[model samples]
Structure formats: C-alpha cells, structure tokens
Target: MTIKVLVVDDSALIRQLLGEIIRQSPDMQLVGVAQDAYVARDMVNQFAPDVITLDIEMPKVDGLTFLDRLMKARPTPVLMISTLTEAGAEATLRALELGAVDFIAKPKLDVAQGIAEYSQQILDKIRMAATSHVRRARRGESGPPANFVNSGTEKLIAIGASTGGTEAIKEVLRELPANSPAIVITQHMPPGFTTTYAKRLDSICAVSVSEAKDGERVLPGHAYIAPGNLHMHIDKYGADYRISLLDTERVSGHKPSVDVMFNSLAKCAGKNVLAIILTGMGKDGAIGMQAIKAAGGVTLAQDEQSCVVFGMPKEAIRLGAVDSILPLEEISRMALAELNRLGAGTRL
Candidate 1:
C-alpha cells in the first residue's frame, strides 16, 4: 500500500524538500501541502492523508493547538517538526502528550539541505506513523491497591518502550504506589524531550519521577528516565544501585537503547531486576531482554492485542526472553503482584 503523506509547514523550502523526499520513496505518495494550520485543516478534509508531517511554529494557529483539534476531530497519526531549541523541546513534549505519534528535530542551520540530510529517516517515521495506532491520551491515577505495603525488595524496574510507549509506560506507572520499587526507563526519544516526558509522568504518577542524572543513587519510589541522546547504565554505589548516563555510540539505532540499559542491568543488578518491553516498532530491546532473562531476572512483555505495534516485545517473546505477556491494562496490576512475589522470594 502506498503511504499517503501531507506536509504542513510555513516554510516553502521544507515543504518542497519533504515533498521531494516523499516522492522519492516508492512506498509513499505526496497527498498535499499546507502552508498553515487552516490550510492543513482543509487539506485534511480533502486529502485524508495517512500521515501528516506538522510544523510546530506556524502562523495563525500553532501546531500543538492544531494537533489537539486534529486528534479530537479526525484522530490521525501526526509527526511534528520543531526547531532544535529548548522551547521547541517543550512544545514537542506537549505534542506527544496531546497524541502526536512522533517528532523530528528541525535543524538549526542549513535550511534546505538539513531536511534532506535525514531523508531516509524521515520516510521511515512517516511510514511508521501511517500504520501506527493513535490512541487517546489517558489520564487519572490508578494507584496500586488501597492496602498496598512496601515489600522492601530493594529491586528496581527497568522498562523500555518506543512508538506508542509513552501512553503504555504511563499506564503502568500510574498504578505504582509511593513504596514501589525504583524504575529506570529508556524510551527512544531525542535530547530535549526526555526531561519533559519525565516531568509529565511525575505529575500523574503516584511515585516520584525525574530524568536520570549521571551517578545518582536511584531510590525506591522514584523513577528515572534515561535522558535523550545518552545511554543509561546501572552501577552499584555501596549497597544501592545508581544511574550513570553516558554519551556513547548509538546502540540499535538509538542513544538510550533498551538493549543497552537491559544489558547493563543484567551485569549490575542481575536477578534483582524486572525488565519490561512495551509497545514499539523495532527490536532494540530483544537482545538485552535475553541477557536479563539469562541473568535470572523476570521479564514481561506487552501482548500484541494491547501493543500499538508489536515489534519490540514480539522480538523478545520470539527470542524466548519474556517470562509472561500481558495486555496494557493488566501490566500495572501484574507488575505489582510480581514485585510482591519476588520480594517474598518466590520464583516467577
């Protein structure tokens, strides 16, 4: 199936570049080009493109507002293009929370060539977004059980997700109690966005959530998200496990790769870890999940019916690394139960 894509940007150069890129991809077709949100809205009605590349900084109406309306009205997959700045980072984060499937960082330099520099990557994201599931951003806290008590296991949860994982990870964390084990997440994201994603999760989760700092002791009841463009590794600080963020070479095509984090955990935390591979579009976590399983850690994967895309978890399951598979809704409850059992010295 030829993927239909609409380019929404104020820059004529970007629109032309994107159009050229789409036309170059055999699987993609250029549906339309809209210079602003108003034009984009009308183009959406007329073209019904499978995927939309939306610029955040546009005149008349901002991309976030337009994205909000698009999600509510048509519920299509949107990939945002934002400037590579702090403000752009914040807006991109909001766009994700508002149901954008993904985003690309607009180059600060080179106007025309920058867009083409990552032409293949642009096409890949557009394809993924075209077939991706766009779900409603769910809210409300579902704290673990009313009578939940600290199991005192000193264990930490390591979660990896991509594509549709922002909401999936949020769903699991929303059920965590104040005494839940520490969590370290490696979600595929760019540098300015992970901090905001952590903050967003912190606001809604029952536990303390923050972006992971290098060499920081990871405490219980706190979740640390691996910052974008960095790889997070687990280390032992006396009796406690600490996080170390490094600017290492990309693993599995991502900086904060799931395999990198999980492999590090397998070496550092060993049997005390609970590794989860959630919805995503690639196999980044599969090998790392195997390492965790080999180290006797409990591994869980999100089942296909609940996954936005079954690529990551499916690879792990096929590799015989996953111990159990659960739907998105049951993941939280099951995680809590597994932690309680693991704390009681039960083998899962």
Candidate 2:
C-alpha cells in the first residue's frame, strides 16, 4: 500500500520540493500540503494522511507548540524538517520531545540545484515516519511522570532503539530516579553524538549516566549507554553483569542494535533482566525480545501512543514477545516495580 503523506511548511519552495520528492517515490503519495500548523490540522481531518513532514519555524504558531497540540488532540507521526543551525538543532530536540518521529536538516542555500541531493534521505525518513505510533496527550498534564520507579525486581535493565531513538531515549531516561536499575541502552547514533548524548543525559537525570566501557560492571544507580559504531552486550562473570563492547558487523542495519543487546541479555542475564523495546525505526528487537521472553525474562514494549516511531516495539508486540505495553513516562516506574517484584518473589 502506498503511504499517504502531508507536507507542512511556510516556504512555498520547500513545500513544492518536498511534495515532488514524496510523489516521486512509488511507495509514497502526497495527500496534501499545508503552509502552517493551522492548515495542517484542517488537512489532517480531511486527508487523513499517514505521515506529516513539519517545518520547525513558521508564522502564527511555531512547530513545537503545534506539535504539542497535535499530539494532545490527534496523535499522528510527524517528521520535522529544519535548517542545520544551532537554533534548529535545539528546536529539533524539543520537537522530538513533543512527539516528532524524526528530523531532516534543510540545506543552507535554497538553490533548486541541490534540492534533489537530499531526496533519498527525505524519502527514507518519510517511510520510517509512516510506521510510527503516536499517542494523544493525556488530560491536564505536560510534565514528566511524578511517580517514576522500578520496584519489582533487582535485575538489570536492557533497552534498544534506533532512528528517532536519541530523543526518545532521553525522555525516558530523564524521568528515572537516582536508584534506577542498571540500564544498558543501545541507541543508533553517530560516534561523537553518543558521547554528547550520554553527557547530556547525565546532566539532566537524577541517576548517574555514562557511556559503557569494555568490561565495565553494570551497577544500580547508574545508566550506561552504548557507544556508537560498536556493539555492546552484557556478560555475566559471577554474580554481576559486565559490559562487552565489540567491533562487529551491523545487525539489522545498526551497529548498536537492540537485537544484539537483547540477545546477550537472554544468554547471560535471562530471568534476571527487564528488557524494554522503545520507539525506533525498524524491527531490530523483535526476535531478541522473544528470546528474552522464552528465557523467562520480563519484557515491555512502549505502546503506540507513547512511541515516536513504533516500528521496533510494534514488531516485538506482533511477535507476542512483550509482556506489557506502557507509555514512555510510565516505563521507568513499571520497570522499577517489576524489578522490585522480582526481587521480592512477588511477580515473575
């Protein structure tokens, strides 16, 4: 089936360029084009597009605020398109938090000469955005979860995400408490960005967060993010699990794939692990999460509404791999509760 798309931008040139790109793809169709969020909203009702490419800067209502409102009212996958400036970067980050599936940097010059240069990337992003699961905002709340803790079992936590994962991972990690379980996350990112992202998370979260190093012991009160360009897996030596970084071939088109981490957890940690599949672009974690479930491990998939891109978790859920589906904000608490329950032998 052809994926229907809506293009939203104030610039007539951009709208035309994006529409042409979408129409050129055999698997995609441009359902409508809007100059701003207001027009986009009306188009959403009329056209019922499967995906939207939103501009970050616009008159009347800014993209971020419009995104927030859009998610709150009628959740739909949104791909943000912005310039590659510092302000654009910051705005792109905020747009992710507001439920944008992914972002593409606009070229500096508006020359029609190079407009086709980014067509492939733009098409790829549009295809990915079509598979996202967006959630409507809950009534009367826009802040982080007030109660965030994992009290069920004391086992380690393993998470995997890709594509739009950088921002999705940040939202979940920022809500975690200092005493959160030892979390090992594999997010698809470039090398330098992972270090910056880890440090960024460390600054915002109550928990101690850092990039995982080879042979580093997984410990509570700390969150370890896998470095980019490498695959990070867990190894159980004695009573504790340690990080194992390897220079390996990409799995599911990602170096630090969720599958690699989840498979390692199934082999080394098994029932002593809480595995979570969050918003991402592909089906990386489905089989691996199944392994975890088969090994008697507890697994959770972020629900469609809470996901920026539902591909990863949706695949896992489709395979009957996830034991529960929770929102992004509720995941930390659910994880903690599951950990505590496992520790107390109250729940499996």
Top candidate by lDDT: 1
Model 1 TM-score (2 dp) = 0.92
Give candidate 2's error at residue 311 in angstroms: 2.7
lDDT of 1 by residue, 196-228 (tens): 788888998888999999989887789999998
lDDT of each: 0.85, 0.80
lDDT of 2 by residue, 1-348 (tens): 899999999999889888888888999989999998889889999988899899989999988998998888778888888765556666776677676777887654446576666898788888877765564433442355334334433377788887667766776776667766678999886565567677777887877889889999888778899887899988887666889999999998888777999999999878888898888877998999999999999999888886767788989999999999998778777876777666633222
Q: What lDDT does candidate 1 reach at residue 82?
A: 81
| Model 2 lDDT on a 0 to 1 scale | 0.80
Q: In model 2, what is the error at residue 321, expressed in angstroms?
A: 2.7
- List RMSD in Å for every model shown: 2.6, 5.2
